[model samples]
Target: MKYSLFTELKSREVIDLFRSVFSESEGEAEGQVISDFVSSLLATTKPQDLIGCIAEENERVVGCVFFSRFTVPSGQAAFILSPVAVSTEVQGSGIGKELIGYGLDHLRSQDVNLAFTYGDPTYYSKMGFKQISENIVNAPFPLSQPIGWLAQSLDGQEIQAMAGPTQCVDALNDPGLW
Candidate 1:
């Protein structure tokens, strides 16, 4: 098991990694969906979002996690993690935990304080993510993975309040995403 910076990810192999690891639920995705979901995931986005960190094993990407910058109602900045995936072949191996730990540490170093994601409470809860109703900042979609929408605070305390919609600013242009 190895952790790689998401920005270092490239090549056809990485795309294969995304597709293979995410295959289980692709059936629920629209027919127009493409694998380029990874293209714009970076800190370089207009609002400075975080890209995904991946876990590679035996020369293959087995796990993936990505974060995006967003504004809460109080105008404070936060990071929203989304679309984490680990291939069935590598499930229950602590790879996801390592990825989250890496991301949280990375965010902390950069002074990013808050994170939002929709995922399994049982799984993400262990990583400090909780279901906070008032501070919810969501993706463009209706949060298909209800159980996955979770939040965590790392470099700060209590999430800022929100009033308007929580969006990724430019996530709509990505062909790889839903």
Candidate 2:
């Protein structure tokens, strides 16, 4: 598998991959929701704030993930990972993990100070994310699954408590998404 940053030309493929992957895993309705979310993310977010990553095999995109700029009161460079998808056929393989690692490496090189993601703690923990409380760093919206609020400091320093609410990009600002 090869990993690389995605360009606008691959937008449709990336969106389709997420839709199909989520449909298989979470049913059709939820799939459509994720697809729409990705569409909004691609269309509305500024280029500098959105980073798309893809895993390709035989020139076909098999897995994809996105990390968008997130804001914290402390003013450090931060990003939030969301809507990760790996093809159902290749779920057991390490493609998802490697793709995420590639994205994080790219972020680190770009001087991103911290990374946050809302998802299954068991799976995200494997990626070095630890559960963090809202008091430490607030999420943009009230989380239905507080346990899944996870984050990691990309720099060597530990995460410090931020003073106010965290803000995600417009596409992810929906309360229902949390």
lDDT winner among the candidates? Answer: 2
Q: How far in Å is the alpha carbon of 99 misplaced in model 1?
A: 0.9
**lDDT of candidate 1?**
0.65
Give TM per candidate. Answer: 0.75, 0.99
- Per-residue lDDT over 115-172 for candidate 2, one digit per residue giving the tens place of the 0 to 100 score: 9999999999998899999999999999999999999999999999977878899999
Error of 1 at 52 (Å): 2.3
Supply candidate 1's per-residue lDDT for 87: 76
Pairs of residues clashing in candidate 1: 36-176, 37-176, 73-162, 117-150, 118-148, 118-149, 119-147, 119-148, 119-149
RMSD to true structure for each model, in Å: 3.9, 0.6
Candidate 2: residue pairs that collide: none
Question: What overall lDDT goes with each candidate model?
Answer: 0.65, 0.95
Cα-based RMSD of candidate 2: 0.6
